[model samples]
Target: MTITDAPPGTRPARRRTIGTVLLWLLLLPGLCWTVIRLGGWEGHSPLVPLLAFTPYVAVGAWVPALIGLLTRRRLPGVVALLTAVALAACVLPRALPDLDKGLSRGVALHVMTSNMLFGGADAATIVTLVRENDVAVLAVQEFSPGAERSLAEAGLGDLLPYSQLSPEWGATGSGLYSRYPLTGTGTRINQGGFHQAYGVIQPDGAAPVLVESAHPLAPAGLDLLAGWAGDMAAEPRADPAGTARILLGDFNSTLDLAPLRTLIASGYRDAADTVGRGLVGTWGPYDGDPIPPVTIDHVLADTRIGVQDVTVHNVPRSDHRAVIAGLILPMAS
Candidate 1:
């Protein structure tokens, strides 16, 4: 018989080889993703925006493992299992709460952050959340003059009277409102023209804390990625010896990105991650898109500050959720 008319036994061997080739093809992407993430090679243009989906990729990594095992390919199965475990190791910690002692002994300060989607978030709902949660400070991004008026009309002024507002006509606006008096208030406009409002608030029985409403430009395209990185890098680093600080709002980045992680490594801890709420998504689908949700908004507090709790809330007419953090500030010595 010719090669085209091979026997049935020979055909089985050919099928096995093809299956092995297919398994490798399926395994390549997951393997590359794990390596890039672990190696910190995701600092490039497209990878920066793409790595935001690592958590989902980590979940999908299991498919290769199962396929490898089902096909009885020992080497591929071993590699696939190891890749899944490695990816999980990188992702699973965000869900586990850290053992943070002495957090309950300090002065309590509750703060909330929200993005108004260019001034369209429900003002009343935001006010209700602030009132119900007893939020001491509120950081708003994409804040506009119309939003400022709507929030004031909704009685937000009655709740958080002290304010350092930079309400522009469009997406560049931002504001920081607090129940406590604000001092040294100003707005920092980043490279992409995104405004970040900041101030110092001294609560009763606590030392002064600097708070900033962070709204770095989104890396929507390759051209914006550098500006996004620059904005994140420009975020103030926490000094354990200096004034304690808190940054809350739409960071437009996830922890998976190297830039955000680098910023967090500078003496600040993610409040949600500290309390096991880090994996919870704060952005996506609120505007009725079919995209998967990701945790882009955050409450990053100084390492000296203690995180008590964190919760996310929904606001109408906005694509982002509001993140509230219960924090403990250091007492005045």
Candidate 2:
């Protein structure tokens, strides 16, 4: 009884030690990573990747703690469970876009659009990453003369098989590249006099997808962006089947902006939002200062297409990082 009774005090201290270690292991890395992400310094920005999916990290950290609680580990378990529920409640509503179940079937396509900063070396990096991801379609905003040639040489031309480049916004509009047969090659959506290219993209064995590649007019002047975004969101849905629609481009407005509200209201769910990667800032990697990043580049989808994953890739040469989304048709029979 002497040794056994005395041992009980040490057992609690040991359990506390183990609990503390688990908390640091499970929570510290993600929390520190979050801090670094939020603490941006110019081109050292990590907001794009963080915003695309940081909430999940917060949710993940609670798993170990929740395990501890269920196992009667006391304080750590309470901390973990509380944190997880709080994060889910805060993130799930705002981050997850309301999407239709039909989006989960049929065709699978991954598309990306980025403003390649015209003369930056990131153009090559963007093209390389896009090909590596095996994206079915590539929509490039700010496609300059020289950068376009570089992307072609980087094998975007050969791998994609079909391509369309717009001439109006030279070095700063939209272009489409596809591995499948592309048709309906014509001007479809125009915003604030900026003509972006749009067309029908037919991936192998899938129905034709309506691609609206745009580089909407930037919100630079006096309240012009509101009207510009309004026009973009109000564009009539012209596709016959409403088969699958992808509105990808550099919209120049954050999701919080009033102008973007119309786009969301018009049955267009942001891919990043649908996936619940909140508050990803895409436009501040090159400018050397700290600024809370905002989601400026977007991939908006109609309910007919399912979003598999939405991510922001790190390409250092450009001012804006790239946004990519993988799509699969949920109802494809």
Candidate 3:
């Protein structure tokens, strides 16, 4: 039943034409996209392809996968399979953003992001990890009133000493705690009913760093993702110091998403990538299955901030693990 063993009849001209069209249609966009991605030279584009066209990127995986499916041609199928594998390696990592093992050692600065589940099941355990690490800064999401009190009692206030706490309408609230002196805090950054806090963190004798602790309204619909991108766009412009920003939170969007692209184009570098760390899945003990753990927590910073190490701390109390990162600020020459 192989093509070579077919009966002594020529294939139809129409069949040949359709195959040609399908081949061209499948190959062209993927090839062009690969080229475009390579050409970017790790530079910024006004609109990042991932965030702007998430659907295109997601479904685009089929180009190579389909090539693998349809082709009987040995060379073509192998090429398609290899291409698909490589792209998947590059792109699929984003699906587990927490898997990124971030910086270590060369850290002049560090931040830890965790979702406390707002005083859910294990508030005490979460607080202990925070205290034990001596986390210089902590960004917590889903803080409940009782959890807040427990965190305070766990010596978070004495350790960080300077902090901002806000209880918004949703179950998720954002807070920032710093060992350094806090210069100021800004108005809320709201998008589609989601509220985030923006503020400044300045250590003694060091230049101030703008920190935005946000849990952007996750996209429940097609328009919501784009709207999230638009909201992030305002951060840099609204807080000019956002270029010197450190964003830590559970974005709920994967690194492969367009929102991340938009953030990177605005001059942020993923700390995990910079540090060359392994995948650190922050969320999901999912029914105790470890094969594919989920990671929603992230630590992103400006390129000027060098990452030395990033680690995922497991807190048995909450559903999400904590993303802890160490950063090195540019040395003054």
Candidate 4:
């Protein structure tokens, strides 16, 4: 054979090598995560709750993958990039904000919600967020007795003139404070058997809006997961006739949960999703993590409520960040 003669099995061997590389690229964790996320797998298992953040995990997988691909720049590398792009295309619509829906015309209100982290959140930090945002109403979960005392000592009574509080021993406690009078004050115990504080707030010259500080149980196990799902399902089927309903606090869930998704599908929209702030993490900087990872806290409003803006703020001495929303609710003439 000449010096340049092809090896006996070179062509088939090369084809097999390329095919194997492509298959491996397609089998990466990123691709698996994307498929699972797109499949909508929310169940009672602990992994299901963890799956709520799969989009972030999928997006994160790209860093090392792209670095390796760029360094290699072979067929496998190209396939990997295509895989990532395909995943992004498949999942982005949910993560991206739907701005096509215009704001509903009405009276505007600023609202904030926080989880006080077992009474550990500093009162001044919480109050500063309230004042800086000019928050008209504030809702909190895990509002323990000590937290209530600290809030009073820090001048929250003067800052927010009206209040409805249900302080339990652990994470069950919840509270709502409003600049406007909170009428029809009631405590709603959700399916998880935790008390949720709710009321109607009347803004001058506007129809009263129903507000609920919603804190479903954290799904740390199967029972809690079931409870969380049940708590979400038990919420009154949203009244979409523009009476204006707002539920804000630590849901212990993300939009990925089937129950939360169903809640939105029924009639409400998350303020952050409405405003185009995609997947801003409101949950953990936990276990030496640098930044918040998943968004479990939320401010959800009825479709009729116009969301002008939504933001999350860092609260000192707490694991959860606070969510603030600027909402315009329909006013009853």
Candidate 5:
């Protein structure tokens, strides 16, 4: 065969080589995620906070694969597609849902959680939300001392007769208020060194529910990462189903963080995720903040409890939106 009739394998071979290189490069994030899932990075990694929104990353990975697939590049396209699938697999279970939309068959208890932004939230708005929603229990983070007066003046005390207040100077305060009687209540300091209050609230005629207001240090830098991890690590590893526990507040971490995942793995589930509202943003929308919205606030509960409804609401003056859930507690056996 003359040179002109030579086999045409060279061009195809070169194309395959280029495709292989592209495939490997495109899959690097997949490798990083594998390390992250295995290493269990504490709240220290900036990537840690971003991990909470893995659905976005997963979607981003699929675009290149789609392009290659349309162009008939088999190997590169298959590899990219596989990588995209892996990325989605890591996050979709939480983002997507198979939640039971059926109404709860148990006793109803409305709970609400909000970070009052160092006492800057509108007292009337807070009180109105509580009264209007028929909130049985409320947890507030950043409960500045000024909040005590504002809340009291706004009729919060009358609306929710029982409370455990740990009023601090600035963003170092936390409190729990309820219509139910709170017993075995106590004071504790959270990861950010803020005072926190927790206790058992027994509804008028229902079984007692263990409620806690949690606020871990925000995962801002490496210096605070250890503390953030420790903060989440210190929580009791009890099954919510066995005792009926409700843990809600500004966790300062998201579902993507390893520490937060660890906390949730211990038998509690975010109320928002329970009904597939996990992707909704709970922070931002304040006029001056540079950070975009994110779902940093949460309401976590035991497995045995039935979630009737879960929602996010605006608190007029606060930066973080409030989360409210209607939970069905198991009747007294």
Candidate 6:
């Protein structure tokens, strides 16, 4: 054989070695993601934004496992298989409905939340969603003065009469409108200057419920990551021994993030997750960008609240899809 020519069996052996290397390269990222996710390292700068796409990564993880197995690399195949399983374990549960057998019977309340995209979403569509869904409460993010006027002109006042609004010029504003009278209305501004409007409402036969429109800053870049984490940390927790609470809007956080998970662990259930609709994407592509959809907007209710159903809907000119949650609130004690 010439210098450049391979010996009889060397070609096959070299090919195997290169294939093994490629297989390991393919397997390593998913393995690292699993480790970081399990270890709660997603709070770090790059990992913060990276973890938001964990669902997609989990779905793609099987490719490496399949490749390794078909290539007859037993160790790499087994490792890749285990890595896929671990990632899947972290993600698949969001698609399965939770067994909420302990939920108490009470008043039925329909709540809808949407991001107005800097007052750009079609107000008529939002009002129609509120009217047709029989929405008892509506929480809006990126609420602006123009949006409020548009919604008012769209006849939102006739249906939901009560309002607590923090209208601004940009994405910093938020508001809460309810069919029932709202008391203790106020706004909490996070470190990122996003407005979170809140109020207490008492439905006909149920206990008082504190509802808040949450709009944490998006972790789009390294500069905003700290603020995003801070805002998420500042979210009001559900008090089991106190008022039943609901927090909903553009959280700018996915269920895979540590901060959002911690918030949910603090006496709240993600409404969509409870009803097996959590995997549905609530943001992306609506603004005409070529981005994959992700579940960032959420309706988080106290554990005592029973989530009967949850759905996502489209709104023209908005980047986010509206999330509507049907909740059963416990009766007054």
lDDT of each: 0.91, 0.65, 0.61, 0.78, 0.79, 0.92
Candidate 1 matches the true fold with a TM-score of 0.97
Candidate 2 ranges beyond 4 A from true positions: 1-92, 96-102, 119-121, 167-171, 188-191, 226-243, 287-289, 330-333
- For residues 1-333, could you state the per-residue lDDT of candidate 5 as single tens digits? 643465786666666667767766876675566457546753366676667656567778787678668867786678778778877766666555546633367688999998999888888988899999999899999998899889999999898999999988788899999998899998788665966689998775567778999888776777877777778788655563456788899987777677777887887767887787887888867635877677889887876677867878889889999899988887776
Each prediction's number of clashing residue pairs = 0, 13, 14, 0, 0, 0
| Stretches of candidate 6 exceeding 4 Å from the true structure | 1-4, 101-104
Question: Model 3 reaches what TM-score against the true structure?
Answer: 0.69
Q: For residues 215-276, write the lDDT of model 6, one tens digit per residue.
A: 99999899999999889999998788888899999999988899999999999999998888
Q: What ranges in model 3 sit over 4 Å off?
A: 1-72, 75-79, 92-107, 118-121, 221-227, 235-243, 284-292, 331-333
Worst 10 residues of 3 by lDDT: 40-49
Model 4 misplacement above 4 A: 1-22, 25-28, 60-86, 89-97, 101-104, 286-292
Cα lDDT tens digits, model 1, 1-333, are 653588878988887888889988898899999998888787646888788889999999999899999989999888988999999998898899889722577899999999999998999999999999999899999999999999999999999999999998878999999999999999999998999999999998998999999999899899988889889889888887889899999998988887888888988989998898889988888889887899999999998888989999999999999999999998988
Best by lDDT: 6
TM-scores of the models, in the order given: 0.97, 0.66, 0.69, 0.85, 0.87, 0.97
Which scores higher on TM-score, 2 or 3?
A: 3
lDDT of 2 by residue, 31-59 (tens): 55444434421121323234434455656
In model 3, what lDDT does residue 194 have? 49
Ranking by lDDT: 6, 1, 5, 4, 2, 3
Q: Clash pairs of candidate 4?
A: none
Q: Residue 217 in candidate 4 has what lDDT?
A: 80
